[model samples]
Target: MAITSANQLELLQTAEAVAREKMIDPALVIEAMEESLARAAKSRYGAEMDIRVSIDRKTGRATFTRVRTVVEDDELENYQAEMTVDQAKQYLDDPKVGDTFVEEVPPVEMGRIAAQSAKQVILQKVREAERDKQYEEFKDRVGQILNVQVKREEYGNVIVDLNPGEGVLRRNEKIGRESYRPNDRIRVYIKDVRREQRGPQVFLSRTAPEFMAELFKMEVPEIYEGIIEIKAVARDPGSRAKIAVISYDGSIDPVGACVGMRGSRVQAVVNELQGEKIDIIPWNEDMPTFLVNALQPAEVSKVVFDEDAERIEVVVPEDQLSLAIGRRGQNVRLASQLTGLDIDILTEEEESKRRQAEFEERTKLFMDTLDLDEFFAQLLVSEGFTNLEEVAYVELDELLVIDGVDEDTANELQARARDYLEAQNAKAMERARELGVQDSLVEFEGLTPQMIEALAEDGVKSLEDFATCADWELAGGWTTVDGERTKDDGVLEPFDVSLEEAQNMIMTARVMLGWVDPAELEADAEEDAELEEEQEA
Candidate 1:
């Protein structure tokens, strides 16, 4: 609507106020005000009229115009939006396509409804601008700590008021036993800023390990200045945590630097976390050495690793077992989390007993499964035979490499293993058939009879079901429980197909059943190129 000079200045002042309140740029607010006023002007003029408006950012002066584009007679489909060359000559100007013409449209007074409509538009624009600002500002601050005041709690989630916008410290991300009242000051790490249907969602976290690290950065000047680096951290949250730090300057001790004078530095962070204990350990590139450092005050006598299983066996002195394992296994558990290894703690005596037990168990297993005598079974167990799968999966050439097993004996041993496996598979196939296993699944060469039965039990009994099975599901992969790798001993050796083999088998099944076109699979290759093109556009 048309506005007097004083009214125009008042509108600009209102925009500035909204911008200040919303923490957005004032220019954007002025632009929104201009747009709102232009829409109101359109209501006063005709809805079909081509209307445009501009506001002076510096002087708060408003301008309005009824605009038209000069186009060829054939292009003048909308008479109100476009003007012809012959008609432009009547106004004494050069008539050409793509030329914009503007005529001053006197500003019109607004009714109550029009004023209310303008107010709604301004509010919407303010919200959109605020979302944009929050995204732009907080996106870069991801993983950084910011102190905020608790505004209120919603549905068990704490809402904290931040500089630009509010952030939600989600229920699960909060440390245990920590509670807050309104206006309580707390620091949180900016975990994420994501756009949602409602608006930008600012996610804050106090329980992330990175949050503890960030607090160390703030407290330790060496870390903030890049003289020291925080390599890794693991937290039991609100109870205990471990941090590994490395110093570039060899003269400086990373742990001592983090601990500060009389532990003041770490104690500051602990105070903020409600007395969470921090273990500052020196980091080492050698993972085993780092694990030793992480499990400080508890000596490790010996360390054995099973790389395939991603498990570590640590042997400590009999007296150190309780200390190394901590109260209820907290020490070993945190060490495992820090080093990214699954650790099993044992005393030296316990480890020796376990070894002897394993040896006896393996000797008996070889004697029974491979039809070997006590002498041969002892030889096989002495050479590290843990189970029947080891004998079944060992190469014939590798078997020749073992001591005391001559050519004839190795051949006989392998033949016995093969015969036993065949007999087992025959029985498994019979059971799978009794369970109504699909022929398509049974016909697949990659799956063993045991796997076929397992698949059938899981209801993957059709070719389509087999095709839909993920590679990890079809073959096998490790899962974790509380960050420790679960002992998934199924699907061992040749019968356990690689992911590529699983994918190939699924595609072969799909092709044989005429379920998918070969061309459709080929089209998946162009998907990345198409996505890049769409992103560029």
Candidate 2:
């Protein structure tokens, strides 16, 4: 194959120009041009014929060929593209099966219609190549900050020209107080890149917590150099934000570093955020101290934490309640987000009232359920026995460790607690049966009759329903109602079962129903955990 036309070199120059403009391999451009020529040649040579074209990248020569495979007469699949030895001898002196034979044909001129069609093919190929490049370039850059120019705005969405291609900064992703015009420059974080039918969607975000952190990293040199690190960030978009920072070096004050000289650095970030208020709090490994810092300006009277529940009760003065809670509960909400804990804010008076109510309820529950006097009930309450189950299943030594409680008394107390529990369970089982609770669930030790009744009322009538419940739905956990993750005031009340107990109950029900493989329960989990610890050691 050779170039006969004078303009053959022009093809090579055009391919190079398009490759450079599109930032693609020149070989790819030549290949796409080759395909476009092949499609054009087919129209002249009849669409049913196997016509191919090759353009030499160096010589700019275009060659056209009608291709055929040498095969036995009986094995020919297509009459036009396959030939026997009788026909093959005309092209090749000796041709074997599976060998291709090409016969050169005169190059067809690119007519008006063919030129138009070829232009479309080349454009489509270039667009696809560009999309591939965009995907490759932006895929790894996701979650990183980038400076972009607002090229266009479509229906409130800012379409920014990225380093390579166009990206979408959606309306919801923009800060609430910030609006953009065409050619307006802004800093955006690459949230995600999705391969869609149209092209790679490079989604940008201006309101992400990471975006703010990135801005701080730009404004503050200490964070960028690794002397200080951002531990966590929580944002209310353009209104207010909280960032927890820690210093790796003992001498560097992380908060002061972020605040900069006379609040200049922070004010720069705030200006970029459209006047968003920022709280740069020092992060501490001590959760109580960190939480106290997270809720700044409003002093915390006390922080009562339940390590088991990972919940915190913050008590503030009556007048400071509103400040601690912020406007529309923003302060506590941001603090919760920063700390990753479910925070309950109350006044000191409310804390006292709640404590008294809880104590009285527990004491009364013990006095009424067990055949104990008020003094004994109060004694059990003071001994940190919250419920009858603790009394029933606690080790005898634990009960004996309480002062004035002998082994005989502990035994008697345990017996009475068990009896009371058994009686309550019997009543619950009856109630659950009346409520149509499954018998398999009834046999599970961890589930109380009241819980069974609740499950039954909530359409969980079968073991499968109970098994498929999400850990959050089964046990209480965080809920996200809107775009943000905030607690749903009331979706489903949680079952008061410890995760281990819930696991045991679900395993028991499934095992009883033959839903789980029994072979999987070969090792005691505790023993397995200990073995894992030993292996780690």
Name the top lDDT candidate.
Answer: 2
Model 2 global lDDT (CA atoms, 0 to 1): 0.84
TM-score of 1: 0.73
TM, every model: 0.73, 0.83
In TM-score terms, candidate 2 sits at 0.83
The parts of candidate 2 lying over 4 Å away from their true place are 1-3, 69-77, 82-99, 307-310, 392-414, 430-473, 483-495, 504-537
How many clashing pairs in candidate 2?
0
Candidate number with greatest TM-score:
2
**Model 2 agreement with the true structure over 83-175: per-residue lDDT tens digits:** 887788888888788788988998888888888898888888998999999999999998898888989889888899986889999999999
lDDT string for model 1 (1-537, tens) is 448887777877888788787778888888777788888988887787788888887777788898888899888887887888888787647777887788887777878888899888888888898888878888888999988999999887999998667899999899896778999999999999998878889999999999999999999999999999999899988999989999999999998999999989999999988788888888988776788888887999988876544568888999888888887788888998898888888899999999898888888888888877878898887777666667777877777777777889787887788789889889888887888887877887667787787777777776778877676666566788765576433332236466567778778888778988988887985897899999999
Clashing pairs in model 1, backbone N/Cα/C closer than 3 A = 2-107, 2-108
Off-target runs (Cα >4 Å) in candidate 1 are 5-24, 46-50, 56-61, 67-104, 148-161, 168-186, 195-201, 285-289, 316-318, 346-357, 386-468, 479-537
